[model samples]
Target chain A: MKVKIKSNAFLIAVSAVILGLLAGGLLMMSIGSNPFEGFYYLFRGGLMNMERIGNTISTAITLMLVGLSVAFAFKTGLFNIGAAGQMLVGGLCATLVAHYVFIPRPFYLVVIIFCAFLGGALWGVIPGILKAKFNVHEVVATIMMNWIAYWSIYYFVPAYLKGPSLETESKSIAIGQTLRSPWLTGIFGGGYINLGIFVAIAAVFVIKYVLDKTTLGFELKAVGSNRFCAEYAGIKVNRNVVISMMIAGGLAGLAGMAYYTGYSRNIQIGVMPSMGFDGIAVALLGASNPIGVLFSALFFGMLQSGKGFMNAMTEVPPEIADTIIATIIYFTATSVLFSRFWDSVGRRKRDKAQQKSDQDESKEEVSHE
Target chain B: MNNTTTKQSLFTSPLGIAIYIVVGLVLLAVMATNHLIGMILPYAIAYTIPLLMTALGGLYSERSGVTNLGLEGLMLVGYFASALTINLTEQTLQASALPLGLLAGVLAGALFSMLHAFASINLKADQVISGTAINMLASALTVYLARTIAGSGNVRIMLGIVRRDIPGLSKIPGIGTLFFTQSYWSTWVALIVWGASWFLLYKTSFGLRLRACGEHPSAVASAGVNVYGMRYFGVGMSGALAGLGGSIILITYSGEFNGTVAGLGFLSIAALIFGQWKPLGILGATFFFGTATTIANVSQVIPQLGVIPPVIFKVFPYVVTLLALIVFSKRSAAPKAVGEAF
Candidate 1:
């Protein structure tokens, strides 16, 4: 009732965020903690210093790319649940290039991009093919691909890229070999800030342009809305499905590059990368728009980066941030209730206007008589 | 035509294929090492029980027209509940603590699943997103709550259900060594549940109505059946069984609530698909995955399996599932109205 503006994706997202915050506050209260104190520390933690801001941005880079991947696939109505696997494969490729490629820095970026994209695309294409050619559900196929990639990385990291003493993670790359540049490091004052930020920003614009302007994007959307209609309209629906997944995989692959090569500088075994799923939330919050995904990823990145500081200062657990994000996604999924409410309000206004106009016409007729 | 159809069905059926794969793998293991089958049987069964229970829970939900991707999260709720209960009560209740903990797990899981039911069924939300929310919320909330109680976000119990042999059954030669020896009581409970589930699903009028709701909710609605009520029951059963599965894992094997079920819930959903939505199919699928996982874990210790890369065994279940999906794509046995909001 209080909402004056017409409900749109942005307002819906804002509403969900507010509800999520309240839910998180309720959780804090249930634990006998001050919600205000918890939130104060949470925001302060993410924006306390230049270094933390840099960390938040770097975190957002990975999340943004993964979000783009999910958002892109969602445009074509495919759920890419295998982003974690794609990220791992992409990270492995980047790690391999970082370790052994021994190329000049000028051309290294190109090589890394190609290798990472190829790796991720290979992983994505299997499920894409399954979905497009065989009618197998992408969710299940991607899930299988995710586990396969997980096990492969679990075996590969230890067997081939083990750190000097640690058998679980790959050896750290030199800063020069990684995505870090000296000037960016100096500006950030010791954070994981790197060229990945630029890449992420570029990806946001590119994905937006592709979705907004390209014929391919139109075809993909067409197939997504109604495959039979798209097919009848002379669009290759199957090709679009495969291509959409390919591009999505490539984006997630870049996320792996941003994370492993740019931020962490190493690959680990047995972890499925929670960013993969968080990206789904990011896509939903963004309403499957590339630009929207960027902002949502940044918001989530702030939550993830700030949680630790909040935990250190308050009695609240770091998991409260995740709890809040989960709650937001829940509210977003159930936003149909909000839509229904909006429709009711609109209907009441229309009815009132109709009655007022009818009363005016009757009064005018009486004056004329 | 009937004989030819039977032959073709035997060769192509998911059950037949799963059986062949298991038997073939067992034979290969036996040929390579004498003691391998006997040694791995107990571990395999232990692993299979959790997956079997979870997948069976999935069977109920999907058959009733709800695509439950939140099985993993529900399993975690049960895992946390059981661990918390057992840890809190082990000193006072002693032996009875285990049963209470399991009951707590089942109750918690069923209770948690109501949220998913409300969102997906009532609100007509996208089932996948709603299920994913359930997964994310349960995971984060459980860990957040667990930190308050356990101090480190993990709940561990000192008392686990110890493995024991059935006195009479253990003496039955080869079958004894494979099935009855060194088994946890939880295994028997899960098997009994599976048997009961099979009967409840196939032999009862209630089960037929539930299955009918999945196939055609409108048709069932015309027959004066409550589609929503049946779906709620289906989802509730899934939650209860998945919780029991989570509890069994804590009591028998894991002995801790570690804020995650390690994707076993997703694996069980894959098993449900692999099994073609039947009780027998699920048994085969879970058993197959369990054996593959056990082999992957123990391959390093076993001389015969050590020659092959552990990665092969680790990736086998997923790869096989993908292949099965491809093979069955033409005529899928999925519930028609599954994932649809009725």
Candidate 2:
């Protein structure tokens, strides 16, 4: 059973990659870009050299965090469109802690990340509490909260934390606090890849552990699978729902830290990055699994990082990347229907084999008689 | 039988009076904040009217069981198209083109929203994903088209429609001056849409059929109603109204097009949900948000409170929106079949 489940997961991952590639190819064709050249450049631009590879991996780290946040919600049957909002809030909070909160060197790093996580979790909890207690749709709640987050970040960053100058941004955090890849420099010859990537990897393991090996995970899975059953079984399903949302929100917030502190080198947030929302697509494509999220995030990161190369290599507008991503998302949204169709086909084949075996046994009995 | 009845009654929900109370208190608070109240209140009213108009459109689609999530995208197209049409036609008429623009907005928005309806109703695509496509398509297409038509990303309405001043009400000492004076055709359109929607949703057989299609399409189909047609009608109406809202926004708020539609369409969705999918409730939500948003933007006028930074005040509306969403989602009962497709 374990082997079968593992193989099925593998198949789904492979199919998702193929679907993404095919969709990208079709988009390139529509835009008159040569697929081969486009893809070649995509690879070359994102991973051709150590520096390029490091940048891609750094981006993937953040993407993976947000992607996992989205997947966590999906696992619990909540569509968290507020990953963007949560990330913004998280970024804001992480910035506050890193800049204002006094702490030691490496310990401060963990504290700031935690602060980001808490900020995101708080934002997420608003929507979760609504959904759990009031039966409000998280979709609408999250969307609205995103605007609040925008204004909050806008006001807080510019007004309260403005440096000695009148600049809209805050004072830059000390260089010691910002994430860098000192450890990975030995391996990749001083690339941009940082400890954040390791954090991302560690997150995947933790999510897997919490989900597959814990009682809390069991309760969450039960509630997600069917609220009525969980409720009837005397579980506080609504609480678990809220908890799941908090976890999801926290993960997304960490994504913001990975993005702002690690990659952008600034604590200030202006526009809601598409990364938060794109995580939804990534989560969906990964089928809401932690390991799947890791790969899907990498894939999406590579695509984004490769857009410049793709544009240069072909007449295909770089905008084709967005079109392809959107198209793949469209397909992924319908994946539930596809899975249903596939399952029915499998069931039918099994039924036919069972009937044949029964007939064969009856004939053997008659021959024996 | 008595025991069973009691058990059933325990499950039966209470009326959502708390929503009204919270909404009322929030409005009163906005009104009470004297320094910032003047700017925020009018802005909120102006913004709310159009958004409420769009939410009515959403109410129709959702009540009919197909979620029109592409509303934001459709509104963007509506906004740009209305701007272009008004600008182009006004060149010939010089002034009457504003009303003409509203008409054009409705038509263009209807046309765009049909694409969303077709994808969901015909292709059976997930409504959320379909909405996302429409949104992206609208965003990209609007930017491209607006640039092409206006010869720039920004299109200035040469002679924009001025807000009509109500003589008696505009003279009212303080609050009346803001709410009643110099309102756009959108305010009238919003009221009319609200009335017409109320009538259509509750009084007409078509609305009943639409609701049936949304809640239980299979049953409605068995009852001899065309589920697809009803859903299309609901969604199409939603698109047209959202378009009108978008156009109104372009003409009144920004006086031009600069992707200023921002995320109002999505906000309208929030209003729809916050309003609990009811026309009256949606109106209140629209007004509430519009007021809060307007107050946040204009509260910078008072130098004393200005020290607090206007952004903090700007957070009020969103906080309320979040509160309302939490309050409503948990308590208010949605239409029996809100997101389910017919």
Candidate 3:
């Protein structure tokens, strides 16, 4: 029964992906473009060479972490819409540590990473507390927090971390201060890939372990499924809510570290990270599972990285590519409908089997008579 | 003695004369300090109208039990539709293009919101996810279509209407300066809509059933009203108002569609919450937020307010919104069955 349920989830996810792709194809055809060629270039652009592959992985690194953050919050029945705010604060903190704290490379990196986690956790906990104590809708509070973080960065970057000419972003961090280790870069043949990819992979396993093998995970899942039932089972629902948000915030913060330090090497002002919201699509497509998130993030990473190349190759504009991605997200968001359809199919098959068994029993009884 | 007694009673009432006195004094101080304050007030009013209209839209949807977080997206779709219509028909429709464009916007917004209603009501999808998807689709589709059709990513309309004074009303003292002068016609339309919304929501039988559905769908269903239909109606109304709000902004303020609404839709949701889903409360909240936003833009004209960083002025409204949500949310009684699938 358990295996059947697991397979059902897998089937639903696969079908959703296929349907989403079909929709995207239809959209392409509507725009008078060859969907097949568009997809071909899209894949080629993402995996044409080692350098491109490394860039794709680099892009996936942030996505994987953010996806995990969102999936983790889902496990606890909390919608962490404040991931963008958390990312901003996290990236800002890491940037600050990277600039001021000059120590041994390993120690500085560890300190900076920890600071990023704490910053994200701090931003996340505000909404958690508001939800727990004040009954404030986390959605509204988190959205408000996003704007606050956005403007705060706008204020902070120009005043303290202003680059030489660009007023919109901070000065780039030196290589030693960044997450880009020489060894990793060397293996990627001078690609943009960095140590953050490894961190993201490790996070997937760590999150999986924590969720599957811990009492805390059990309690959080219980609360998510039914808060009243969890409370009746002697779980502290409010504390779990706060703890889940903090952990989710911490994961997103790590993503911020990867993005600002590893990929871009600088923090930008006024722009909320689109990856924060895209993480929702990733989480949904992955069915909110850590391992699933890893694969889905890789897929999305390919789409995003390949979009520019696809635009260059085909008459299809970049905006159309965005529409395609949004279409996929729209389909994935309605995954509940797909599950219901699958459930009905399963039920129908079971009903047919039961009827066949009954007919065979009746025939045997008549033969004995 | 009788006159003093009457004055004392007025002061002691909850809607007290003292409150008006305080407001009057603050206005007097602002006008005395900077005459530009009077000029900014009209702009604030103009800005507040769209927000107020959008909030009213949110009120209808939420009251009927479906959370319409796609207001921002709906607004964008409406804005794009209206802008395109106006831009294409400018040569033929001329001055008549404004009303025709608005009608197109309302229809487009309603049609777009039907996608949301279908997913949330029939498919029983997560409302927030559905809303987010709508937002993504709106921005992406609008930009894509705009690029393909217009050969540019923005749709610019040529029908820039001149602001008209309301004849004798514009000559009144401080009131005329703050309310009547330099106001767009859309402002009056928005006010009329707000009054109509108040009447419909409070005085109509349909409103009672809609509110009941939000609070308890089973009870509403038991009473022989279609819960799903009511939800659809609520969401459709929200979309129409949001569309009108978007059209108003394009016609009166921006004079173009840019595939974005600057998060005004979300701000309207904030206003809805701040107002506790009441029409009058929404009006007051919109004005407060409108004033807050206008201050950020008008700071350049008021030299005395220019010293503080412009970012602070920009951030102030958001900060105030956050604070307001935190303080009022606990006391605010939202519909019990909101965000739940019927």
DockQ list for all candidates = 0.58, 0.32, 0.47
Off by over 4 Å in 2: A1-44, A100-105, A163-166, A183-192, A309-319, A336-369, B1-42, B83-108, B111-126, B129-159, B165-181, B255-260, B303-309
Off by over 4 Å in 1: A1-7, A349-369, B1-26
lDDT of 3 by residue, B45-81 (tens): 8789889988999999999899988998899998999
How well is each residue in A210-282 modelled by candidate 1, as lDDT tens digits?
8889898798888777778899999998999999999999899999999999999899887889998898889
- lDDT per residue as tens, model 1, B113-180: 98888887898788888888999999999999999888878899999888889999999998987888
- Among incorrect, acceptable, medium and high, the docking class of model 3 is acceptable
lDDT of 2 by residue, A1-369 (tens): 000122355455555466767866765555455788878887787888877777788878888999889777766777788888898888778777767777776788789878889999999998888788777777777887788888777767776677666465666766566666556755666645767887789989999898899988888877777778889999898899899999999998988888777776564546767788678767766767898888888877777777777667665555445555555565555454445556788899999899899889999999999
| Best-first order by TM-score | 1, 3, 2
lDDT of 1 at B63: 97
lDDT of 2: 0.75
**Residue B297 error, candidate 1, Å:** 0.9
Considering chain A alone, what is the TM-score of candidate 2? 0.86
The models' CA-based lDDT, in order, is: 0.88, 0.75, 0.83
> Which of 1 and 2 is the better model by TM-score?
1
DockQ category of candidate 2: acceptable
- Candidate 3, residue A123: how far the Cα is off, in Å: 1.2
